[model samples]
Target: MTSLVAGALLAAPGVAVAADAGAPPQPLVGDLSTWGSPCAAGEGRPFVRAVPNLTARLYGAGDHQPGEASRVSGEFEAWWLDGDGSEERLTFATGMRSDSTPFSWQLPAEIPADTVISWRVRAVDGEVASPWSTEGEGAPCEFVLDRTAPGKPVVTSADYPDNNNWTDGAGVYGTFHVDSPTDDVVSYVYDFQGGPLLRATPSGPEGSADLRYLPPAGGVFMLHVQAQDRAGNLSSPTYYTFRVASGRAPAAHWSLADAAGSRTAAATAGAAARAGIGASFGSPAPSGTALTSTATLDGTGHGFLTPDASVVGAGKTFAAGGWVRPSAVDSVRTIASQDGFGAPEFALGLRQEDGGPVWSFAVNGTRMTGGLPEAGEWAHVLGAYDAETGRARLYVNGRAVGEEEAVTPVAAEGNFQIGRSHGASGYRDRWKGEIGDVRVHDRVVAPAEITRLGSRAAQLRGHWALENAPEGISAEAGGGEPLKLAAGASIFRAGDECDLLDPDCIPGDWPLADEGHLSLDGTAGYAATDKPVVDTDDSFTVSATVRLADNEPAHPMTALSQGGVHGDAFKVRYTPATQSWELVMSHADAPGAAETVVARVEWPDGGQGGGHRLAVVYDDATDRVRLFVDGHADAGGTAEFHDAWESDGGLQVGRGRTADGWGEYLRGAVDQVRVFSGVVPDQDIAGLM
Candidate 1:
């Protein structure tokens, strides 16, 4: 890397000399370079991988005359500093003008793992050779060559075990130990889920680092770590998988919102229930998000039952119920219940003798019944128990109805039942009505919060209004299946962000502030769903608010996309050159398939602005894709797309995947993302905005 002037023979590695009266001015060798070095060395030696393509620079020099130019030949010499003065030389001509040019040679092989290299250059003709090049101080120029990769690092956590079982709680922090000290590792690079690689420096020569990280939400997550040596060499990554139990999350929730179903679907990851022949799903529900699920049961002993174990223990505090609308109040009709060997463990529904149905919140045989709910009218009913006070309360439409009973409910540990109950006589009292948003909270609910459970919940709580930390990724309007974290995106406060779903389970450290937006570095970070958000072949809508770090980038950048076999099935990206927002749809999942870019709307700022509400809808019915900006249809952003294929990859926020890995990262903030199963109406999209 070192360079020297030919006129100054006082010091340094590059050879230089002053023109004498007689001979051609000694050719000057300024500096040396290796193909492996990413950057040039200006003042000191450079480090390069071994067996590099080495080159030396020689200045034009006079051959026949000491002060004039003439054709000349040059010799580049290199020697290993550690080896006995053995030298290697290569020869080249400077052509007609004896012009300055680079002379290259293959660096010596068969060298030790760590070696120091030095080189010099000179011009020669006939019987005369130019003085050897050297630094002004007569010091040799040298560079270190290192080719060995660092050893793999070991990742260990004392608090959370390997992916054996779910950790005790969500958001629990674990300090992971990383090191391969003896291998000359200087730092560690790690990331969560597939986020971004963050560097952690070692405390000392041990090359050991302890990284403290916490899971923002529940479900399975992984941490990747690798050792980085001083020479910028990285070892293969060590993957650490961990699980955080959804202890505070609902044990099970049936939205009953399926379009048509004999088998009911659930929002939560586990806790699926089976619908009986007489039970049907996808019925009209009280005004709510389209995600709301409603189920109807024909009174002929029909209902839904989950094949899950009892989630609520006898002595534990819990809340269970849903939205209900009954047909007749004749017999004891149960909306939801858990079985008991003899009588029913508990049931919440409508029951009255001679007149209108009365809302009932019954646990065992003790019923907290009152409040007349007109037949065929929708009502929110809940049965909540607090073990600490040994009290049970029934709520109708956010208000406690009937007297609060201090009853000790027996353990109704059995399959969760819906629309029917196992009374002493037999499996009777099948519900002849509609039930929606059935949920079971395995923890005690404070009376003040019970009121916020139904139609009374906040406007922006997504499907269920569940609270999540900045690190945790919730379903938004998508429902209970929270998205998994990738490389870990952090949260930042955007003036309009909302975080009203402050559930009891959220950790204390999470501040109850404005809604936080996702901050991505346009790298390997994004939020991912466990399964594909939508069947791309079907009509669907994807929307979110985005603010990019820069509106005009050198390349196209994606705000959201889903992966296919070789590329993305669909991409909501900003094309820098066109200054337009485009929705690209792929024809197939394989590589080099025909692609259709239907929507193209140039931003008002001519690619100078980045904040906006963006949405893309693919209506399979018309085979057209529509783009919306700030909830309004974009005339310039509409066109037809063909041969739409279904993508099986999970929904990815802030990035698009290529054949090799993730790319097109959105470098900015994204908030309030929502993916709907079907095309959302124009007015509805605006209303959501």
Candidate 2:
């Protein structure tokens, strides 16, 4: 007989169980209606209700029934079905004896959100199979995993400072802002074209990124920025373009060119003249004869004359009047032609016709040509060709001499030379006659204006000469003493009775002369006087034409000094180690108190032994200390000591203070010694050249 264990059954209730002794129990087979209690047919009976996380169980009868066998084996299976009866296997248990109890099985991991898991169970005891239980349906169970958060960050604002005008060597900065979900920005990257890549921590909340860049050169540069989240999600790249300019503007300065001392041009002449004006005319003048006219030649030969200098025709049109009598009329040429020195070679004052005094101008070398002027005595020539108006006219002595349309209308090269062509090489065509009252205007000059200019020219003659003498001091002495102007001469005499206090006894009669000649030789060295002696302390420049003598020492030699035993006083000396001239300042009373060495200059070997001009200028305003040899700046330095001269000390030249004799006395000729309180620029130096 099969024995069934009555454990807790999670199946439909009210099912009939046949438990007989000594006979095999028949398998229970009936609809879900038959498994109900007898009180209300099957419809009123309680059935298994499938709920979430629950399973159903069914009991089976064994094949050993009554007294046949003690135990019976069986198998059971369970499955789930949908509302349409599509079934999916749930669990299957094999080798289950009749004594087997019910067990629970878990459902699959994944299921539809609202699906009902309806399941039923069946049992087979030996060869007898039990009927299938009714299906059950219940609410479905599901779980949701969500990772989407608040929202993605949005770029709110970006601020990039314009570095377009930034100097090349200056630092630049950039900044930007972004709207982020939280204060947890992960990383940021910046790409620059020239330098290294820049990175920074992404600012949280009001997200911001500040970057600095130092540009190398001038050009357009592109930059970009990218941001990433903790998950390494990178945002779109933002780009910008900027420029780094050249160096910043320099401090304002006003310096004269090297030629400012010689040629004085009007400051208002315009920028063209300012750039082209050289230091000197250097021998032959570029222009033929200096045009002493009040007219301003509008760099284009068309003249803009003013009445102040009798060079009329500021805005006049010419029917024509005036005579250009050359110094000698060997070859008649037009007045408005290029001539005399380089390039444009020579321009004809007149056209190629020799019949009469034509007022036309022609460019000889270049392809520029013009019309002919009227002919009369002294050449009262007038001609006109209207470039914009397309008209031509000619008059001689206020009368129409000829009029015609120009066959080949060409523009003049605009460079007007008085004596020759624009080429100015003194070539084929040249002006020989003397031209007076040469005037031009924007429009053609009337006969009355021409006649008036001619009458004015007759009265105005002679050259405008410079009135004041050139501001300069000669080598000649100016005081009561006879001027000592020789090359190798000394202006002092040595003797005990030589009026040491009188101005007449002083060789140069220097303004600050106190103690006069201490020795016949004008070489400076330590003196034997117990009383503090007076020397040349007055601010003066001692310049000399130095010619190195054969016996001169090449060691540390003093050129000039005032006081102190050895290294004291302001002196110019040479250092053998550096081979450079040094301007040393020392004081005997204050030893090791920081004596200043202002400037040093090295001279080549061949530069010595030759006659050279040496000048030392001490300016108080700029405290500009300078020393020049052979008209060139050899050694120069600046200082702030305005009053370097002591009242009790007399000035000494060519050597320093010596106890026995003039040891470092310059063994060379000394010429011009000039002293001025004003500062001279390079232009003044070049003027002397």
Candidate 3:
């Protein structure tokens, strides 16, 4: 007798020793079963469906069995059908397993979402092998993995008391509530002060939590919260930050961080400086800070504080500025108006009197006009008066736009009002839209000082105007970094030209309206950022206003791109052949490349030329890309582009890099090019227009 047969008979708990007459032992049979997979029912049971991320435990019981609990030694084999009509064998252990069942195996990893997996298992003992057990109600297992991530947590309320000075309190407490997208949220992680992340417990009500922390001596506190689902998927975090009187105290400052609330003075600036809140306060404007809010006004009412002779003395030089967003191109929206009608003191506002919206500064009736800003956009308006030179200057976006000389200055008597004009016509010329970071200085401020304030407040990474030419190196407005233009690029001043199709079609101000555009020669002309403006796979937005020159070409004209290789990174290209604009995102490995066509739109049949403002946003949380044309969602937009981008070269404008050399040069005028480090909301994109 064979040694296998002898051992089988001796070790068997209840089995009649039988020989196959030198032939293969009688085929073994038992029950084939699966566990752990939700779709699996019982022994020899068929599976209905399983999730792709799940691991199915397949096991089989031997027929000539030892005791029910005894370990059964055997070899197991399994196979499943692939999507392409091919059979793939599964790897199995040769030794019997002793967990749950005598023999068990886990299905392969990532079995494709929503795929029908038909698998069979058989057991073998030496030369004896059992026929594949029939699946009860035999059918292939189907599964669909839950690949979607939960929505971001909504920060409903974040409130913290203003801890003004060193005396009021050392620590401030804040309460915030985050509404989870689903009920499956296991917990929330609160990242405070960038220290060890803390898991928040359910506090007041269901979705709220309390946060209290002491500031780092003179520093402030910052809190960010993220939610985690039961499946271990984490939602994007939201942040809130509040200062604790760290910097120098201003003579008079209104942070305007109140949302539908009363305004207050900085504790360090003294309590007498609080400005009276206006009734026409609308909603909150973007403050750039997490916790603080900027007040919005509906062009009515006004906030006023008792005049501080030291800061607003008509005889003393003074500088005033704040962030403003106008709702429309209406006449005279005041920022600061002191001393009512009757040839008052000083009044700062955006006036359309000089044919269009201009930042106007008036002191003792002598007025100066600055560059006009588009409606529905934020602008930094600053005006400074030199008591000695008798000169009052207006600066818009940090550049001196207009200036005027005056005789000896005269001090006026009245309260300093914000957002409304103090005219004999009662409350006239109420400033519309939002205002924030309003400050007043007793001393005259230089041009360089105003630029520094604007730059610091904007917190921008790259702001390229492309106005400088011939070796076109323009200073970035947000930071005075030099942006080098190469390959025969030239400046295209809007000049005496006007594009009627463009909404900013005012013929007189067309030059300033479109400003200066960088023209590329459709060859190897482009501009590059000094540093990497955007990072690979980061949440960032690239926006530019592009006007195609009158020429039909065969190749694509790249307006802007990163990642030197044409086939491997983000590219905004316009193909003249098809009159189509496309945003392509691609990924590559040593093996090959894969691409996600983020968006592609053809110019409506006959529509061509003129300026089209295009924006592409990469939303980090969703791993998706969105395309906007003319301030709206493009025909092809909001698509998935999860490929990792290569950060090999500096961000380029007007051309794409390839193996040969620079190519896909854009033969057009590109202006107002901006790169931001986060997803630009739709409404903001619309305002870009």
| Candidate 2 local Cα displacement, residue 382, angstroms | 57
Number of backbone collisions per candidate, in order? 31, 59, 0
- TM-score, one value per model: 0.35, 0.23, 0.35
Model 1 residue 172 lDDT score: 43
The model with the greater lDDT, 1 or 2, is 1
Cα displacement (angstroms), candidate 2, residue 295, comes to: 46
* TM-score (C-alpha, index-matched) for candidate 2: 0.23
Return the top candidate by lDDT.
Answer: 1
lDDT of 2 by residue, 384-501 (tens): 4333344445444334444444332333323333333333343334444333333333333334533333321111111101111122111223321122122332333223345556
**Which scores higher on TM-score, 2 or 3?**
3
- The number of clashing residue pairs in model 2 is 59
Residue 585, candidate 3: how far off, in angstroms? Answer: 20
Please report how far candidate 3 places residue 367 from its true position, in Å.
0.6
lDDT of 3 by residue, 1-689 (tens): 11121111122233223333422123223233434443342243333233322222222234333433423343333344457655544434446553235444555554543333443444433443433332234433333333344566666433433333232112222355666756656578887678888887545455545554434233566678787754456777777655544323455776666445555433224233444555333345543333245666666454443344334775876778877777866777788777634644787888886476778888877888867565665667887776756777888766787556674575775667677656665656777777777787655555655765553222246777766654468667776445688866777665446676788776532221245767777776788876577765556788888876645655778888877444536878887766777787777522235666655564622224457888888864346788888887754677876565546667888887545556888876777888876666677886654
Residue by residue across 1-689, what tens digits does model 1's lDDT show? 22333233221234333444433444343455556442233345665555666665444434333354455555555555335544433223333234344555665465445766665556544334456655343344566677777888888787667868878645345688888844567788899888877999998457789887755556788889888776677888888888877446666677778668567565663467777888788788764334465888888855655544565677676788888778767777887777788777787787874565578877867879876665565677889886656788888866787799987675768766788777668787778878888888766554555555643311331231223444566545545556655664666543324443544343322212234556667676676676686777756788877766664676667887876768777888887888777888778877777777755665633222446778888765346788887777766778877577778887878888555567787776666677766567677886654
lDDT (CA) per prediction: 0.66, 0.36, 0.59
Off by over 4 Å in 2: 1-476, 480-540, 550-554, 564-568, 587-594, 602-610, 634-643, 658-662, 686-689
